[model samples]
Target: MTRPPEPPPKRHGVLRLWHALRYSWDGLRAGWREPALRQELVLGAVLLPAAWWVGRDAVHVALLALSVVAVWVVELLNTAVESVVDRIGPEWHPLAKRAKDMGSAAVLLTLLASGGLWAWSLWAWWRG
Candidate 1:
């Protein structure tokens, strides 16, 4: 037998926007509660204003800010992956370990990129 059609998605407008914002805030709060996420957030808080000061122009500022944000984004994704893996079970499975390790590697790479970008901007500012 054929399955019934799925219901249409809810309409998009002001109410939807509000819900999206609320959900985003909830996620931020959840991230903040996590120790590693909290530390990264504090680091971002410090680096953001410093970026404004160190950047020579809007482009430079954007680059620096985006890099920092990218790291945070990757970290959040990594956290999500780890959470899911842990939820599945506490067993020492190879696939689970691999997934967590890959997520961690992603976060590490993002951090390295952010650091490199900031360094490049600082070097340019110092030279000019």
Candidate 2:
């Protein structure tokens, strides 16, 4: 006899929230596990608020906030890329190193862009 198909998973609201929290907690844990990430988080937290204060209007403040968030987003993506690359090969590999380096470069680009945005906005506000 043929076996029956499996039942669909439950979609309770509380359970969904719990799952979301679990994922967020996992990401937070991973971020804190790295010293670089911890430093980045501290820097972003300190800089974004100052940027907001120096921003003349809501638009500038919003742009500054988004730029800072962009940095963190890229870092998260870089971490994920590194994790996957490591999983694919436990041993040392040149290609894996290249992949990680590219991810780090992306994060660097994001941070540089954020710094540019913050500096330009603050400078304009200061001069005005």
Candidate 3:
């Protein structure tokens, strides 16, 4: 027998916002629990303040901060992908490997982009 499809859950106004915040907090906690994510969070803690000190102006500071945050965001997403893939099974599979590898690659690209932005900002400041 065919089962009916589930209807979408409804959330309204303030309640929706509250749920969103709660979900975000849960995600952050999960990320913090993950080793790689914990490391990135620590890195952000150090770099965010340094970004403010090293940046030349408000725009530079914001850019630096956003770049650092971007890395954290990407890392969290990568962790999510890995977790989901791992949950699927313990057996070896080409698609699982590809999914995990791609997630890692995404994190690497974000890190590289963030690093390049910071390096450029420093170079510009140095030249001034």
Q: What TM-score would each prediction reach against the true structure?
A: 0.84, 0.82, 0.85
User: Using lDDT as the measure, what is the rank order of every candidate, best first?
Assistant: 3, 1, 2
Q: Is candidate 2 or candidate 3 better by lDDT?
A: 3
In model 3, pairs of residues that clash are none
lDDT tens per residue, model 2, 36-124: 78888899889888866887788877888888888888888899999899889799899999999999999999989988887888778
The CA lDDT at 114 in model 1 is 93
lDDT of each prediction vs. the true structure? Answer: 0.90, 0.86, 0.91
Judging by TM-score against the true structure, name the best candidate: 3
| Count of clashing pairs, candidate 3 | 0
Worst 10 residues of 3 by lDDT: 119-128
Candidate 1 lDDT over residue span 1-128, tens digit each? 99999965685899889888888898888788888888888999999999999998899899999998998898888988998999999989999999999999998999899999988888988988
- What TM-score does candidate 1 reach? 0.84
